[model samples]
Target: MSKVEIYDTTLRDGTQAENFNLQLEDKLKIAQKLDEIGVDYIEGGWPGSNPKDIHFFSRIKNYHFKKAQIVAFGSTHHPQKIPQTDPNLKTLIEAKTEVVTIFGKSWDLHVKDALRISLERNLEIISDSLAYLRSHVKKLFYDAEHFFDGFKDNPEYALATIKKAIEAGADCIIFCDTNGGTLPFELETIISQVKSKFPNISWGIHAHNDAGTAVANSLMAVHLGATQVQGTINGVGERCGNADLCSIIPALKLKMGIDCVTDEQLAKLTSVSRYITELLNIAHPPYLPYVGRSAFAHKGGVHVSAVKRNPQTYEHIPPQKVGNIRRILISELSGKSTILSKAKEWGIDLESEDPEVQKILQELKDLENQGFQFDVAEESFKLRIYKARGELKKHYFRLLTYRVHDYNTLDGRPIAEAEVWVEVKGRERHAISLGMGPVNALDRALRNALEEFYPRLKEMSLIDYRVRVLPETSGTEAKVRVLIESRDKECVWRTVGVSHDILEASLQALLDSIVYKLFLDERREKC
Candidate 1:
């Protein structure tokens, strides 16, 4: 089998997603990352549509890509304009990318309704557009927009459109599921018909997720001998999103025995998925396949036991193959093997028959019953293990008391103030600080009091804090769970706390965050 080419359109089609905007610097950074991951092409953007994209094309020229070619995307010439003078085609040439992709109307419905041109005129537009750019760009691709729907509506016209493009020197013909309504079987039948007519031509598949079959359809296209796969990282695109290359790339390389990317490049898949989401400031969906946080996590006792003996019992592939780690979740459903696996992961020695394992298991169940979730708070669970083994003997600081106050200014701004008292190594300290909210003020005040005793505490800061109201209660009496994500220069960790009072819950999580940091530092020093 031939190696499939990966064309990443995250900077182009991906930006069309709501709230998925990226600055020029972000695009540049992502382009570098895409090149590092060995994508064949990076669709920069439509330079003619937006000033930002134009600036991106200009700025990207400074960086040298080792593997990927930067691609400029645009549309066919307008019916009223000549291809040589069309602004869209002119801008595609000016972008100076080695490769260019332009979409043309394939569906006769679009020719009549969208373009409002005669059928022959649209075909002329496709032929003229590709011919004009073929000489200017080193490689040209024709995206047959709505190709499958067009084929179903008028097979002859659809075939004619691509026929003109091929004759005009298009290097590849990409069949796009523009409306994302094509299913796997439907795509299979259409592509089979199309390929039989043009077996020698290079074919690619571009799918959308409206029908929730984008990845399935893409794989089907590959199974039928399509040599190129176009998608975005994490599937960020207009509407439901494009096919997720994060899932497709691994499936091709690992499952289908295709060498689309080298092993080292494939291992960077998880981090690249996360890096794009982090830059977009969107929460990465933990349930996403392959690279998601929960993709390889196990919670059932039976499943954990089997996986401990052999990961293949429950997992489809090794989590480390995609730069993801296997997670043993601490929950009521977990058994002794789960605890033992988690302990081994954290470098703690424990036998299967250890009594402390059962003790820790019961403690986890009791705490989870009280709204304390340990699955997302592995640091808190690790602390529990240390306490169970009587290893957490050192107390860095003892909290004496804390208070928070909120006030409204005449200017309509709200102010929060917190005062904290703590005792450390026979010495006492008191500090007060103002912050954006009660939780923020409390975190500041506590750090102010403790940073003097443990200077390294200044290095760690809270990155994310989320509050959830437990459904077991309601109204003002409802219990709240606070999850705090903290990070130092080294790594990030999560801790959880639950209380009827939101402030108390926040403080419990904050305390765990600080203690986890201190514990890590001590462990590192001892090592």
Candidate 2:
């Protein structure tokens, strides 16, 4: 087994992906996180490409990294310009990194068509630029631009480019499948030949996912003798995307017998993945490999039954290893496991031998056939189960009826207010409050009515709100689904409500949010 180095380029290549931008602070935070998690190298950014990265490397200069090296990424000295004269090269030097990676044309077509440079001239550019950097830094890496295609088209010239970089004292050689179209078997064969010719030199592999084979090709190259792997977290990059380090790291360390980081904190894999997503405010990849929400989940009745008998029956690996949990969801296809697991999740005890359990499962099936989704609105699902089991306790203030009145303004002012009437423990209570919208008015009115009883509600607030309007007709009347997101000191959750009346949808959504918060308080008190 070889000691495979993991290089993280999320700050660089990842930003190339549409909408994956990180502020200077975000980049620093992610860098610190990668360092904390024991990545071998954190490629800060392409200093030559933009000002943000240049500012980042300078800002992070004083920050300490215990386990990883910070690398500055850029391209080879412009066409034929002198290395020192090129601002691109100057920025790389100013990045304050011990390691720098520069790319040069590896494919013959890129040379003649893309770069429009003679093959021999491109070779000299790679050699002299690398040699210049070698004098400036102790570590230098050369990216063989379009290397795999270059290998297939003109094997001799591509090897010649590698030889130039090696002779120029490049510390590591990385073959970039810039187009991301290479196949696994082809990558293995090319990497084998590169190894045979350059037996004494260390090399890295950077594959993209255009063909959806970046991960496979990366692993194949590693098996064929490459010692270093480079990719981005969550597979963000230009075009199709770069290899996903989240998948590659575990496959190398846990599955392939090679270890990168010694931090048992590797168990926090999914947490780290989610941490990045939260900062980016992007939806977490549900189908992400190794640590996704669905990675260990079993949904179908047959699969759930088998998995319940033995987790290893369907799961490739234990969910806990990657900081994920097995979730058996309740749906039309759910079996008894759904009832038992969901019951366990809600702290409900339903004996397996109980005959009523079957009836409740059937009821769940029927409710699912209705427009109810239990996955996102877990509180609603729990309430149904409790009611079915004769365990539901009504709120101290159960809502009777509510009316929201909104016009341009009360008296030449833009104001909205709501009136609420509710029977709390059989006593009638009423309240009103002004708000930003009809939903806001309703929420405020309800909360003001219950503020004395459930004062803990004040601790939480609605952070975000989303509405999905579904159109049945091509024109006017469209039904809308409102998904409200609320968060307190602990965390945030989403609950959705749908109706043709937008205000009614908003009201239902607001109710879900309040009930969910109350349930959380109750559960925490019990625990």
Candidate 3:
């Protein structure tokens, strides 16, 4: 098989995604991770558009990479001027990277309407940009923006655009599905035609995911002889997203037997995918292919049984190949076999015939029937397992009573105060605190009461709180389920609680959060 280059544009195109902004340090960190995973090209960002990217290119020069080439991305020169005179081109040159990628208009409609220039002028822009960068950079890739749409609209003009870039010394002519409307079959046909026309030229593909076929289109193009594939780590980009390299890389290397990153580097794919999402502060798409949390999670009884006997029965590839583990989800739908499998995974030596397994299974059913979703609350599920096995320690602190008061202050702003009484290590402690809301006040007061006994609680804090109404059959008095995410220096864990009153539900979850933290502290000490 041909060697396919993995060009990652997470820093550039990915930041365009909503709520996916990253700091300069974050960009550097992601770049390092991508390099470690053996990405061939890392497109830092568009250099001239913003100060952040300009600073990134300047600072990144100090760091040396092992395998990946750091590529500066930018658009072709303005239609009104030569490449050298274009400010964007000048910024690309100033970036001083060995590899530079410049995208130019291929669609006649964009050239005629968006650029408001003739198709002839657009051709000049493409050639001039590639020729200018070719001398300044060791590798110059020309992105034929909207090449598929342009080819379908006017094949002659679209082919002319890439032909000019190749003739003018573009290292690789990358066909782009800028609008992401092209299907896989359409991309295959168009890519094959382009490959035939320029049989000797190196080709690449950059696909977007508007129609949800970016990954398919990209792989089809590669099968049709394109050598380079450009995408983001988790397919994060403007609109839907670019093709997900997390899926594409493994598909290429493991499934197709194509050489991109080495086996050692490929194993880091899941870690890289997760690390990028953490930096973006975005939740990982749990259902995403290959590396997603649910990708290898078996929930059904038959599926879990088959997976336990032979993972290949339900899984396409071994999860550990990409640093992900096979997961057997225990739920109301799970059987004793599933519980046994999950127990083995958790290092709990529970036999299939163990009465405790049946007990926990019944408890899981009853809790889930009450709106407790174990899938989202894994920490709570683990705690239940420990409790069922009679291995759970007693709570570090027990709440005696708590009072929350809410009233308008002199400034007419509502103020909430909480008085918490708790028994810690057989000693009663009392504390009062103020907060923006009743829940916050309760949390503060409870922490204050327990801090004397468990000083380590100072490092833990509630990072996220969510409440979901159960059934809501009773309009005003519906039971609410609260989920609280707590994080310390060590790790993040979520705990859940349910009650008719929202405040009470939140307090239950908050208490569980503190208890879990204390448990971890005790566990570490025991170890």
Query: How accurate locally, in lDDT, is each candidate?
Result: 0.93, 0.82, 0.88
Candidate 3 accuracy as TM-score: 0.94
The residue-by-residue lDDT of candidate 3 on 1-527, one tens digit each, is 67899999999998998889899999999999999999999999999899999999999999889999999999988888887689999999999999999888989999989999888988888877787888899999988899999999999999898889888999888999999999998887887788778889998899999999999988888888889999999899998999999999999988888978888898899989998888767778999898999988988889988877888898899988888877778678888887787777767799877899889889989987876776666677777788888777676778999899998999999989999889988899999999998999999999899888889999998888889888845778788999999899878888888888899889877877887788778777321
The model with the greatest TM-score is 1
lDDT of 1 by residue, 440-499 (tens): 999999889988778999999898999999999889999999999999988899999999
How many clashes would you count in candidate 3? 0
Better of 1 and 3 by TM-score: 1
Query: What are the clashing pairs of model 2?
Result: none
Model 2 agreement with the true structure over 1-527: per-residue lDDT tens digits:
67888898999988899878799999999998888667888999998888898899899898998988999998888885988788888998888799888888888888899889888888888887887788787688888989999999999998999999999998889999989999998998888888889899989999999999999988987887787899988888998899998898888877887777663656777888888988999988888998787787777878887887888889877887767888887677877777787787667898877766788778767755544455655556666677677765666457898888877854676668899987765677899999888888888899888877789989878877777666554444777767787878886766767777878878877787787778778767332
Give stretches of model 3 more than 4 Å off.
393-395, 408-414, 471-477, 525-527
> Is candidate 1 or 3 superior in lDDT?
1
Model 2, CA-based lDDT: 0.82
Poorest stretch of ten by lDDT in candidate 3: 518-527
